[model samples]
Target: MSTATITPKGPGTLRGARLPKWSPYAIAAGSIALAVGIGLAGGLHSRVQWGLIAAILYVVGTYAIATAVEGKRQAKDRIATSLVWVAFLLAVIPLASLVWSTVARGLKVLDVYFLTHSMGVVADTEPGGGIYHAILGTLEQVGLATVIAAPIGVLTAIYLVEYGRGRLSQAITFFVDVMTGIPSIVAGLFILSLMLMFDMQPFGFAGSLALAILMMPVVVRSTEEMLKLVPNELREASLALGVPKWRTILKVVLPTSIGGITTGIMLSIARITGETAPVLLLVWGNAFINANPFEGAQASLPLYIYQQYANSAGSGAAYDRAWAASLTLIAFVMLLNLVARGIARWKAPKTGR
Candidate 1:
């Protein structure tokens, strides 16, 4: 008599038949290959369309194969997983492409000299021009806005979290809410209206005013949230030690949340630094460096990029300058983020070693 060996199945604790580990990878590869074939055959141009096609094929192929081998439930789970991955790629690819394109085009004109010089006498179509003036204006305007907004925002947050009560507090909160939702254009228009009434001219400080209006709500919201996260035990301990309420808040509460507060302020600064509308409406884009922001029209990086692109008229030089300006602006924002991260790390509450 001939005996046959038995192959044991998976544990009973593990329910349902499962597809092989390599099955999804195989399906994805096949889907990509098929999508490429279809794209070439159908003469489709957009790579985005190809990616979508590949994503669809991958999902469909996974479901069909999984259902055939395992079951409907497993197939549904796999489809969901595939879809999430596809969604992530869809979001990330565009951003990656933008960075790549900007770097590629910006390198042609970006240099130390390009950064240090100004476009004072150079025409828009000229090959040699720099964003020094724009850079200076951005610094002054954003710095001034921060100076105007940060203190008020921090104080308001403190009041809301600590001393606020009843109708007055509610009204302040309500107004802050309304201000937070107000558009940059609306802030610009408000300042513009004031300027129109007083016959004021476009100046960097005017842009700073509009930017301050936009920055305040963000700073307030962020600071309020940070203050709320500070443990009440700290406050109680400070108060129990015969410390005055104001002293306790100043010494204990502020220090504890300083990291987050600083981070939020930096992020707010970053947000306003990129704003073009308010600057365009108020500062009016100057090509020459105006060291005095209070008197005359000023240039900013966003406005510089916009001006270059709009006047490019398909000229390669202008396009390159625009890309370089964009790269510089991105770098500035990235630097702010790095600084915020550094501050957060340095100021974070020390835990048990």
Candidate 2:
């Protein structure tokens, strides 16, 4: 252990080496090219197989190059980075393809007339129909479900966060967790059992009830987390100022967490928006317009999409309509997410002067 060996330019001491940032891109390109060549030689027809091969080559190449030039630690870090990028591409490519395909096919018949009119008089095999009835039913049913589920969910969250303790709280928590995983079909069946007991027919309101059941746990969990995030100091300060616990929660706590709660509620609505099984079991889907959700079976977007695809899919008009409806549903969910983001931004606490 001579002091000379520890010096930067001394012999018997290792010199540090590092790869340039562009090394990753270079490696990736080379890996892809090599993979293509290998695939061609091996007679591999699947593009998926080629992509996987390229990813494997990229990761292995990164590790080997980094280990040679840098060290084992840097090599391991590069391997992890490559794996993350691979995972990200795996998640994104399918979604991008789905959106592109939906848009391409849906544009064929997704005009103003298609959106504004209904399939009331149009035959299933005919080339002209619309989703107006389904849209109306969807809006009404989802709106009703939100109204039913949101307040109950918020109240339950409030109770759990502010007042919960002992066996009662544990029971409530247990049930909420259980409900979170309950299948959409089970919720539909539960609502259907009630309808059967009352000897009632399918209606949009029944579908709303089923959707509400599905939305509740999501809302509860999200609201509960938001509530828990509110600072305890605020509660104590309000109580010290002679404010009631209820008033403190209403004024200080709920306001602080309202943005998150609203976002959660919107997300919950989005979650239930695409549920077809519940709507099929409870609403029964009417081709004809049924303006009264309480009186008769009502069409919904999910149900309409399912009916089109199941009954007459890939046949002239039905296939086009199904793609259009799917696009519409995707748009609706996207809009909900956008709205949630907007609301969350609007209601977020202002931090700067």
Candidate 3:
């Protein structure tokens, strides 16, 4: 008698075969045919809707049928994976479209003169006007707003996160939420009224104040959340080392949370930087360069875009300037983000400490 040797198959060999790549194509073709049929029956508006219905039905029906053929668990996993990828693509499409549109329109008039010259010489028909004054004004106003807002916002956030525990905290939270919901126009109006009461005409500084009001609540909320994430152990450790409460908060809690607070400040800056209504109500500059924010009028990037686009001349050189100004504003925001990231990286404490 001879002995025979047996070879056992591996576990991977026991797995079910994958569906053919042609399966999705076939499903899509069938879906399109169904969509066309429904569209013809329903006419124009319904026709458009039918295509969406058909696509959704095809995806769901195909998944169900596949699951029935292949086991429940595997089919569910595969379908869920497909849907997730589809959702991601759907989101990216609109974001890509928006960036493309902004870039295309903005590139039309972004030039040296557009950056150097103010709107002084550039007429509705003329094309060589620059946004230098607007750029300067925007920086001044936004900087002043940051100066006014950051201290108040950070302190309020610290109070809420560190010391707030009573009904007063709850009241403050409610009011901050309410302020966050207040429209930019309303803030503008409030600032305008306050100025009028003071018998002072609206100026660039007033616009900064309005923007500060709009920005402060946002900063407070974001910073409060960030500060709340600081470990209580850090505070305890500092206090055990004979540190006073204020010193513990300043040295231990704040240093750890500084990165996040800075990020929130940058975000708030971005939020108020594009506010048109507040600047419009407070600042009134026609074309001249006004460096002074307190006594003189000033123009900002957002106001420049508005003034240009709202002109009697619909699509002219002035409109091109508006587009260019928009691009500059976007560039400014990008720079601020970079600076914030740098600060965060530099100030971040060592990990695993």
Candidates ranked, most accurate by TM-score first: 2, 1, 3
Q: Please list the residue runs of candidate 2 whose C-alpha ends up more than 4 Å from where it truly belongs after superposition.
A: 1-15
1-353, model 3: which lDDT tens digit per residue? 11112234458776554455556556656766777777787674664477566657566756875575555776787678657755774588678876677778889989786788787766755777788899989999999999999999999998998889999999999999999999998998998898889989767899999999999999999999888899999999999999998899898999998998998899889989999998998886557788889977898999988888887276577777777788888888988898888888888887764
Clashes of each: 0, 0, 1
lDDT per model, in order? 0.92, 0.92, 0.82
Please give, for residues 140-200, the per-residue lDDT of candidate 2 as tens digits.
9999999999999999999999999999989999999999999999999999999999999
Residue by residue across 1-353, what tens digits does model 1's lDDT show?
11122234468745556666777777888899999999999999998788889999998888887776677888899989988988998899989999999899898999998999889998888899899999999999999999999999999999999999999989989999999999998999999999999998999999999999999999999999999999999999999999999999999999999999999999999999999999999999998999899998999999999999999888888889999999999999999999999999999999968
Question: What TM-score do all the candidates reach, one by one?
Answer: 0.91, 0.95, 0.84
The model with the greatest TM-score is 2
Which scores better on TM-score, 1 or 3? 1
Candidate 1: Cα lDDT at 53: 95
Error of 3 at 62 (Å): 6.1
- Which of the predicted structures, 1 or 3, would earn the higher lDDT when compared with the native? 1
Cα displacement (Å) at residue 85, model 2 = 1.0
User: Could you arrange the candidates by lDDT from highest to lowest?
Assistant: 2, 1, 3
Cα TM-score of candidate 3: 0.84
